[model samples]
Target: MELTLANVMGLVRQTFADPRGAAQVVLRLPMPLQARWAAVALMAVLSAVLMHLMSGLMPPAVGPDGQVLPAISPFFWAGMVGFGMVMTALLAFVVGRWRGGRGELADSVILVAWLQFIQLLIVVVQLVVLVALPVLAPIVEVGAVLIFLWLLVNFVAEMHGFRSLGMVFLGIVLTFVLAVFGMTILLMLIGVAP
Candidate 1:
């Protein structure tokens, strides 16, 4: 199916109703890799901007001399988005294959992009709650994390055609651990860590 607005909405609704089925449908779509990557990048930038805006509502981080610290650079957001997209796709492909799944890199990319899109919508809701009811922000944030994780597990299982959700959960946990380890090594190399 084409990537039209109607199709996207329908897919999102379907995802909420049946994530695994939605993932299977998404895999069958003719979305190109460049388009999938663009979607991920767009979501990343939007998420960063929303987070920055949300942070503005709280007390600013101040230095010992009472000077406010500068916010993160846009370049940092871009780099993070690039790294996340690559790592997500790589992990899904490798782990999925290890589990005897037949999904390709492109399929994994689509799955990750869709997941980001869903989280973006959730972030918008959280932002609204933060503005209208600041006290509920923490609750909304926690709920969003749980929802994202649940959706992620189902989507990963669907994408890889895995019968056991446990395998998908394990894959996600392993991916996260490896990603943290890699980032730690990177930070140490850059002299950002002791």
Candidate 2:
């Protein structure tokens, strides 16, 4: 595939039909490391811009304390997304290898970038649904989360050559729990604990 618009659209359809298969296609692409990283960075910036636009279109979100929260800047969202993409790839590479899986760092990077690309598409759909079909926004929100998790589990399993998505899901859960714990300790140490 030459990364043409039509090819990408076909891949997106295939992704919904078979996430692991789509991941295999993405992983096999002959993209260089620099190109992979650039793709991730570009997706992060695009996602941030879209998020800012979506926030502007939607009503203000009320905080738990009954105060309206300020909208996050696109720069901050971009930094967060970019960091998350890099860390997710690194974690998948390190943890999967530790679990006796066979996968390369480059594979992880490209797959993560591909996942981000799919997420951008979902965000666009969400934007449209929020405007034209407000009543179905909740369904779209739930569906988006489900689709994201499904793709993520399949992508990770495909990259690591894992046979059981159940185990992959468990690994993802554990990793997320540990990450949250570590971040909490770091925040506490820095006197920013909530």
Candidate 3:
């Protein structure tokens, strides 16, 4: 089915209420690879913009010279989002297949894209709260993280057609550990670590 405004709203509601049902809907859609990538790109750009705005609201870090340090570039935020989207799809596809899942890469990509869209909504709400009541920003940030984790576990399990949520959770934990290890190695190589 075409992703009209009404359909998208319905899907979002379903995702919030029953993520597995949303995953089923995602799997049934005939979205092209290009379209899927486009959606990912759109989410990445929006996320980057929101992050940039949110960062602007924070107090700038001061250096030893008493000058405000430059904030992170927008390009960096966009790149991070792009990298995260790709890695999530890759991990989901590889780990799911290794676990004897029947899902394909396209399924993983679609599910991740949908999840990112949901996350973008959460980010928007957090941004609004941060603007209105800065003191509540920390609470909103923590709540968003918890909500995202819960949605991700269910969405990953559903996308992979896995009957065991525990297996999916374990797979995610392994992926995260490996990613951290790899990033540490990269940082060391780049002299970013002492």
Best by TM-score: 2
The candidate, 1 or 3, that scores higher on lDDT is: 3
Clash pairs for candidate 3:
none
Off by over 4 Å in 3: 190-194
Candidate 3 residue 167 C-alpha distance from true site, Å: 2.3
Candidate 3 lDDT over residue span 91-133, tens digit each: 8888888888877888888888888899989988988888898
A best-first ranking of the candidates according to their TM-score comes to 2, 3, 1
Worst 10 residues of 2 by lDDT: 172-181
lDDT of 2: 0.91
When 2 and 3 are scored with TM-score, the better candidate is 2
User: Model 1 off-target regions past 4 Å?
Assistant: 63-66
TM-score of each: 0.87, 0.94, 0.92
- What TM-score, to 2 decimals, does candidate 1 have? 0.87
User: Native-vs-model 1 lDDT?
Assistant: 0.83
lDDT of 3 at 161: 76
- Candidate lDDT scores, in order, read 0.83, 0.91, 0.86
